[model samples]
Target chain A: MATLKDVAKLAGLTTSTVSRVINNRGYISENTRKKVDDAMKDLNYHPNEAARSLRMKSTNTIGLIVPHVSHPYFAEMISNLEARAYEKGYKILLCNSQCIHEREEEYIRMCINHKVAGIILCSGSVALDVFDGVDVPVITIERFLDNRTASIECDNKQGGALAAEKLIECGCKHLLHVGNIGTLSMPADMRTEGFREVCERKKIPFVEIYTEDTQYYRMEYDEMLENVLQKYPETDGMFVNSDVIAAQTLQTCRKFHISVPDQLKIIGFDDTNIAQLTTPQLTTIHQPVKEMAEIAINLLNDSVAGKLVAKRTVLPVNLIERETT
Target chain B: MATLKDVAKLAGLTTSTVSRVINNRGYISENTRKKVDDAMKDLNYHPNEAARSLRMKSTNTIGLIVPHVSHPYFAEMISNLEARAYEKGYKILLCNSQCIHEREEEYIRMCINHKVAGIILCSGSVALDVFDGVDVPVITIERFLDNRTASIECDNKQGGALAAEKLIECGCKHLLHVGNIGTLSMPADMRTEGFREVCERKKIPFVEIYTEDTQYYRMEYDEMLENVLQKYPETDGMFVNSDVIAAQTLQTCRKFHISVPDQLKIIGFDDTNIAQLTTPQLTTIHQPVKEMAEIAINLLNDSVAGKLVAKRTVLPVNLIERETT
Candidate 1:
């Protein structure tokens, strides 16, 4: 309810004088600044943001887009990015696309229209063409676009290799790498490349499982993996692409009476909260999501300041051995 | 790299004309709009946000403060709030306080300085007196403040009562309500009242196991509950205050070889994603988080437009049945 006019009138000064003090624009006496501050507290004056944003071209905010915040991947990314952005005195506009491409574009349009300092993309299949020739700086995590657009991704290839190596060390013979590794779905490439390279070097027979092009969350891959295990009971080792996949595998393994780390030395990616929730706490490869998110926010901030950011940034991954293998 | 001057020069107009085009203000011809749009696209223009914010007073964005985005309870709230806010063409500024009072104050100050349209407090433990004379409209969820301020919360009494009735129906002789009830740490008075009321009516003996004042999360509470179970082995039916708590109860029960429904039927609250993640699934109370968020935004929007809003908005809660009960 308080207005700048109220504070100015109470301070017995011109509104422009009050404005200068609040915005710290023009020179004003220290005495007048103190008077204005006291009057503002008394009047509870908050400079109208809607009005002020019309003059200041930058809101000191960034727009963040993700597929699902409840999902471990996005949740961790959001917390990490939020802490980092706050440290830089910047706020984050969180957008949950719910894994829809159109929703992702909707947020992008809003970010452009609002003139955010930077836009960070953490999820959704955002096409590079959409950002082609766009004016604002765009940064992607786990997804990459045109050359100007920067990217921060986990070394999924390394994660894949780690899981494979762990499974083999656990004395697994027959292995089944159940996941979709294609061009459209971004990180699958690094993971599949790593998994395949390790399998080839080990001279062990491996089977591949692919799903519908749209199954980005691995929900659709659950049933397919169930069938794979049923069809190949001799498969002693399973390298799951995600923690959620490994969780579902535990449930299915329970149904089939397949013991984990005994009959199935399963290794999952993304050490999400669910990784620990599963029955045989999933042996997972931990993606440095928090570190990556912090780095992404910094990179976006630097780019907004017109600093050169690396075209590609890769985060590390670790194998957290738990109950399952 | 394009500036307002460049756009104006290319459009054969003044700098104010380009500013008006970007702001969507004043009377401008459709032809002029088209020409400005074309010029902006051709020149790859991005109007600086700070300059615009200086005039607008409000940024057409809302600030959301939560404890942690990685937790299921807050993550669900974030996802729900983002979905609803997006539909209303409002963006969100995320602030994770980690349940620290100082961090919450920092977020509040940041929101005020940035001049966001309004703020939504998803996690609150701050003294209501601290925000007594603030200028902006703040809506708190699951936390009550001064009578003058607005709050959107689930009918906690009903949720507690619902949990009690379900647990009683499961045929347990003696039961205990697990959570920090009415303590400043959690301040979950509704659950406490609901369980006490139901027990009094049924003449069934009940005990309260309040965890020491500490942070609330699934993993942390799981360890606490494990200790509580050892102290009160007679506690057969549990009216746990959260789904994450219930998930841990199930895991610890497994560790102790206490088969649920057979030995200890459990009922949790807040039907978060963790409900599905838990084995035997958790039968919990459903809080309409998305609708609550939508109302928070609408109430703030009305306040900005100089309209009255309800001081307290209470939505209905439901009992979702699963294996736990």
Candidate 2:
């Protein structure tokens, strides 16, 4: 029964301040926020979005579909995206598609029907057909969906090249490149392309290995690493597609009694938390996760507002040299 | 301009199968799902949630509020929760409060306003006052809000006791327990309490250290570890609150020229991905994140359906020993 005006009057603040607290649009000091919240509570003001939807014809929510948040790269990216969305008066409806095409399609359908302002797909499954004829504003991360869709991604090609260059500079004669098998057709495959280019140009003998995509399950990484090690026993350096894979490689190297840098120099991509957690902290290609996330949200907001945005935004990546190299 | 019946007929499947594909409620074979999807696409049949919501008078969505998903534990938990929710025809609206009380409170208010059928709070901050007089069914993880809100948590006290016992059994005379400074009053603080109890009962000389909650910001962990090592140079064993912290401890120990297991036995809680990624893989208390997430969702659903649910659900924890111990 209580309105925003009453709550603002009670809290001695403007209605915009009270609206900001409800929408989480902008910064409000803790003291001001708490006072407004207390006043709203005291007045039993329940400003439910369901009611607002009927009048406004929209909800302040964005749908975010990721392969899986348990993966460190996506997890950190989702964290950044959620923070930026909240600052811009939007919340994320999270769907972990687990890289399944059917599941990703289902989430896209759900988003289209849920009246969310827009959708952000952090998947690389090349399944843009699901969004066909859907009117919702769609923004993608790390994958190029279609001509109509806006996307933000770190330069995977540049990242891969940086890794290859670093390993070669470290005098790695016999190199190995490990990547997720599922990401072969996605933009991330550029990492492998870049790595291969450097290896070919430098006249370095290198082997390319594609491992299964899953990361967290026990012993899978060990098994993959074992197969790679047995097949390429002469490998003196490796460039992994992601930090998680690089960490597993470091662990496997330890098991095989291979000293890093001295025997097997390693470089990883997407410098997520795992890069630092590893013993000889990974020298990785630092994907601009926060920057990409912010840009994705901004593009999504622009699209939702019926404004034209760039078709593709490529952020920069840098090589962070740490103990691993 | 197409319908479920039309798609089902074209796909040569029952309408229920097509409905399952649309709602994603039950298990459908991948082949059947694809056939149905192809039929729907060919017919331009877009089954969205808005129409379903208007008919059912409820949306199949849950609002999940966590401090941040970049933290390994929360990321894994969100992954599990999303999987379970999708299996039951629900999606997650994610809010990362970033451990700010005002931000978290704002999220709760927004959830109350939104059409999400339920809300799950994965925050440790005890600011339940924000939920006062809210109508939505609420469930919390790892923090007890009130009698009205059902909560699920791994036994932090038992986890702490296990950590202490393991350290002592490993011949650690001088021990240390490190935890987040912000969780001092929450249920997680029970870990510290249990560790202290074991130390007091065994008469082991132990020191307690609390660090700021922010992580992944460069040099904070280093500074915290520097201060801890400077103050307690004789510490032979440690029980860190989380695997992330344990990894930092291990890295700091390496810098300080301390060998793990031999000179400094260490154990961490949350047995998250970081537990295995580290070089000397951490021995940690395993919190059944998936099981807890499933239970939390079930309770929220029960409450949403106007059924009474238990006030508290405490899951079990296990001690997983590895190289660190």
Interface DockQ per candidate: 0.41, 0.63
**Candidate No. with top TM-score:** 2
In terms of docking quality, model 2 is medium
List model 1 lDDT by residue over A1-325, tens digit each: 8788889889999999998876555478879988997887667665654455566655566888887787776787788898898767577888888777777875776677666778888766776655655576788898756665589889988988988888887888898887654535676567877988898899877887765544554354557777888788899988877776777777788778888777888888889877776666778899988789888888887887778889899888889999988
Error of 1 at B285 (Å): 1.9
Shift in Å, residue A195, candidate 1: 0.9
The C-alpha TM-scores of every prediction are 0.82, 0.90
Candidate 2 at A156: error in angstroms? 1.6
Worst 10 residues of 2 chain B by lDDT: B211-220
